[model samples]
Target: MTSAPNDLAFLRRLRPLAARELRLALLAGAVAGVMVVLQAWWVATILDRALVGREPLAELVLPFVLLFGIVALRAASTFAAERLGFAAAMRVVPALRRALLGKLGRVGPSGAAALPTGEIVAALSDGVRAVEPFFSRYLPATAQAAMLPVGIFLVVAPLDWLSALVFLVTAPLIPLFMVLIGKGAEALNQRQWLRLQRMSGHFLDAVQGLASIKAFGAGPRMVAEVGATAERYRRDTMAVLRIAFLSSLTLEFFSTVAIAIIAVLIGFRLLWGELDYRAGLFILLLAPEFYGPLRMMGTAYHARMEALGAASRLVALDALPEPVLASGTARPAFGDGIAIRFEDVHLTYPDGRIALRGVTFAIEPGETVAFAGPSGAGKSSIQALLLGFVGPTSGRILIDGHPLETLDPEHWRRHLGFMPQRPKLFAASVRGNIAPGEADPDDSAILRAAERAGVAGVIADLPQGLDTAIGNGGRQLSGGQASRIALARLFCRDAPLALLDEPTAHLDDDSEAMIHAAITQLKGRRTLLVNAHRPASLALAHRIIRIEEGRIAVGQAEPAETACPC
Candidate 1:
């Protein structure tokens, strides 16, 4: 498709996945509609026979029993429709969530970070949920509204054509007015969704940066900003709700007026002796039943508006490109370790910031190389490129004599162990954090990795040892301890190429020494690419490549001792 379709079109595309369940729900609703006609027929017959014909109460027992049975069956069918529709909606919500998460993964880190985290969270949580009612209530109600009113008119025409004419004339008014009012409600709902997204993003940003705000004594200012955003969202919500109430009132008023007109017509015809009592009563009994579906449809129409608003946001998110570059199908073997070469590599981010310019570098197989530079000197950018988190804007990254762009990113990453500057730890036990990817982790292997990373003694000191819970984001541990745990995780991977980006930065002397020792131990066993600033860390590298202002400083790629020292 050249351009993505609108929210309604997007919803239509997803209909096939839950077609069977939705069809069953429609079938149940049709049964309920038929029961409505039959129940009204039996009720009118029973009332006419008892009061107008002077029939015995016992003579109407069968009709009363049949009417009760019809009511029960109608109730059952309505319940079945509701349950089936809900089932269909549940199926759809999870599929949408999966598509969103899969898209998030394919976009990689840089692309995901480009979107607001709170807005993404809102889409995955509330946005997907708002769509449920469209499938569960709105779709079925529309079908019922279409089928019920026409069926009631057909039944009434043979008995009282004048009442049937009134039904025909007034029936369309409910939906016509429904459409008119719904247009305004839909716009309000869309604005409400946008405001909610802004509020969610602002609140999340404020909470995440609470520590910094407190440190800078900006707590009151931050709170006021958050309150303002929340207030705006609340006002948007109230406006939408007001529109919804108005729509409901308009539907009720028209349907009630139509029923009253039918009642008045039937009364005048009976009073003039032009219509039989039984026929007039029958026509009157069916008036409200005819308009019942229309009123229900009006209420459900609000759900459609809410769903359209939510689906619009979801569609916008889905339209973003997964990766700036498509990953190739090639999986190159790194039998003799990965030999990488950057040929005049240039890196520019989506935000128009140039990270690297004409930066040339090479890493020999199983070599320990350090990229030493000040902050924003392209060291981390190089690591991001190597890890396949992103591609070079205009350059070539070759791996083991194969073009990096031509290699499958997933397969290529399997051979590399990466330790980022700030590593994330899940809410799991310490042992689980160390070997997060292992299906059946070996206790001995984990202990060995932890010991190599110099965290085994620290783990032993905790009350629960390796099984201690780290809490979300490793909150139970200190920064140094968390870093060591991440290093241990890298060791457990046993990959051929190990990338450590500023592993010792911001660490205490003890933590730094422990990491340096781990580096010394793994220097020859694997190809090591480290981004370091401390002289001691740089000394471990066989060669140091110093970068400055998006380019390699001349005469800086040499022995570590002669390279620029921090």
Candidate 2:
């Protein structure tokens, strides 16, 4: 992952996606090169006949017409070549984004915990965008560099071997310098790219923590720090530009020298009467076209660096462990209610943190069980396993005597109405937030769910009632109000099984009382698995299961002495 290949695995990986696009682009470039040669021939023939052979203006009409036709063809072919290159880029970008997103989803929350959120976002967005040029410009430039020169060489060699030999010898040197300079630029570009990710991540973190910054009176300091970060990025960008300028200069210098050499050789030969003006003019016109491909290759070598920098991160993202969630084939549906059993379940995260160990428990049909544990005591881990967010490292979770993995995850989730510690609400109307996924949404059902969750009074107080825009993350609502709104979503589901984690957590006394009332409404109507440590919350449970470390205690129900830490 550090190296683009460690050998050429990156190219091998890309071949499948880009092969067809690149082939079409290359074919189009070859055709364009043919047009360039034909246009050069038409122009050279017309000039030779009029200037040297002393042909009348009327006699030159055929050559002039052919030259005009060739010019038009060249213009059309150039347009086609550009369009073909862009089409190839378009083919790969979306596929790459989809595959990356799918892979991240599979990794699950636990698997992705170590990565920075902003960097992941950048990689999926801007990082992916930066690579578009690699396909549209770099790959086509590469194809033209390889194919165009050979076509030009073939035409020139027949007309004049000396000029062709000069082209063949000079073409290799341009790329030689390009490779040597590019080796150094690759590392610099990669370093700058990684730094940009860190800067972006820091900015995102600052935005998310803006409230805390204002409370702590660090807003000005944070702004200054952000400015410093941007300044550093600017420096890195300047360095990249400097290297790019040097690369272009080297290419331009060498190509100019090669063209000058060819023109000099043609002039000497024409003066000695060893070459006809017709053939001499043709070779002279072709000399720059011959090196055109090499110059393009030199420019595109920088694109290679840009792509490799992006690809290194892509490779690293791809190299992460496979997703822990298993997608079972059989469609799952609820009947009555589900009985659950945990058989020797264990959980370990990527950073070697163990969350559960040899734990075992069960709940019969329609039973309401509460798991009480302190922070990091495997309470949430159990919920994660049951919800199909992440699989246990070992052992099995059986639902109604059937292993959970035997059921399709999407179908299994439909039977669940889960309310996590902090349920997310989008920037939508209260009704939309309450009933997000229904194919045909019902206004009455949304209002009913809101009323049942004891939050109808809160929403009714808003300016627009159910039609009010909540703003991003439901920013307009208080903590208790947000919790009540999430509970409303669960009421809307009315699924067979409900998982509520710290349902009243981080809420004011009023909010806690509201959620407690909602829980009172849900009892016996649905099977509930609640994770809590609050005496208020634990008091609502029919049975209490204590979790210490990763294992369940061997005792019966007990009163909550303190909040959490069971």
Candidate 3:
């Protein structure tokens, strides 16, 4: 919409997971840290007791009991944390998806058409999935790692301040190295994701255009395009892998060096007899344990980068601006019928291509109007304006007496039916395709609509009537059949206003006549705007409007012209 904002900032705007789930996760992590510290304390106590006295075999009972309690508590806490984290993650995903979908919905079909289908699919699906690891593993692990090291150090400080200080000072290096290495990794990860989306988009396009490739005998060329896309994706993936490997190695190296330094210092203190056997053993054991959580935390940092990369893309999609609507307004009523007026309406593309320049026209309620012009004469643009797919660059469009901009786009669209130049059909049964999931069109109504569109015969010949399954994109149906099915859907809609974009474009004479009959039947009830190049389709309209070079020529009502020789 406007200027694109920073991705990270956009991502942070998403509401975090539920507070209760986060609280439980943190509580579990705290308990787990305390358990680890207690386990360490019991081990040192057992070692000290056995060294000095002639400890009986039964004397090991208390330490073993403490060990069992520590382990059991730790296990329970781990389980709880995992369960809570997963629950929070699950809750977040749906909200994120809803937000993404809502944003896209607000953008409408014209805005969405600017982006590739594959790219949108990747952002919605794969991008959403990436956040799972961050929530379930990295997030809880980060909390546990932060709490555990501090808790362990507090316990050790009472026994030996010197050892605790050493552990604390060295632990900072692990995260420092991790941050330094991962700084570049986030950028790389973002680039990799972009490449992945592009590759997916290219692949989907190739698949969709497979028939065209076969018809032209250029299947091999299409195959080569797919191969090139795959290879580019592979290269991008390998680059991400290289950076990730280096980051992991750097974190591990720093952790190892820190652990070594702690070990050396403790060994010297014990060798010179400055430290007792019990304290030396306890410090030695606890040193590694303290660093263990830090090491895991460092690893989790890399995972955070990966999640953030995906989140960045998702945030971008969510940040798309919604259409503005006037407040304190009721839905416009079209009792007499819906009349449309364009008062000096101007429309310009984002790239500064003007489609319609100061175009003005008016259509009365229940009138059948046709827009006839050569391609790029803004005929379809006029229909798009009527449908409120795009706001005017300047001027106003009015329905009844109210400005179109003042009306809710969704509410306005609900009263309108449109048939595009190319209609899309989902892979679903005939009834499902016709009515979809939203409209619970009864069998009788569905059959009536199909019959009106002259497609009922085709359905009746099928093995299962309306229950027959259409392949992807209605591949099982011929082009004319698909058009008729789309028309059937439009008929089922039963809107007050109808916008037809070459509704009979590719049909034969008989099929064309059937569609024309359907339009004639709609004449008395619905206001119609038809975009047609053929004379037979135009004959149904009462008025013919001519558009040329982004301007409409206002003239008196005339008999419909059969052909465009202009």
Question: For candidate 2, lDDT tens digit of each residue in 290-352?
Answer: 888888878878877887887777776766675344557567566656789999999887788
Best to worst by TM-score, what's the order?
Answer: 2, 1, 3
lDDT of each: 0.86, 0.82, 0.79
lDDT of 2 at 424: 89
Worst lDDT 10-window in candidate 1: 319-328
Best by lDDT: 1
How many clashes show up per model?
A: 0, 1, 1
lDDT of 3 by residue, 1-566 (tens): 21224554554454365557877898988887777777776787787888755588597997788788888998998799889888877877788788788778767666566667887899899988887677776778878778888877887788778878877787888788778878787777777788888888888887878889789999898889788878887887787778777867876777677768777877898889888877777777777778787777777776777778887777667655443432214487666369889899898865577999898888999999988888998998888777766678888888888888788776887788888888889888899888876756599999999998889999999999999998878989988889889889988888889999988887888868877887788886889999988888778888788888888765523557443433
List runs of model 1 lying over 4 Å from the truth: 1-5, 52-54, 324-327, 330-336, 358-360, 401-409, 437-439, 552-556
Question: What TM-score, to 2 decimals, does candidate 1 have?
Answer: 0.92
User: Between 1 and 2, whose TM-score is larger?
Assistant: 2
TM-score, each model?
0.92, 0.94, 0.91
Candidate 2 TM-score versus the reference: 0.94
Task: Please provide, for model 1 over 498-550, each residue's C-alpha lDDT reduced to its tens digit, 9 standing for 90 to 100.
Answer: 99988888899988898898878888778899999888889989999989999
**For model 3, what is the alpha-carbon lDDT of residue 3?**
21
Model 1 steric clash pairs: none
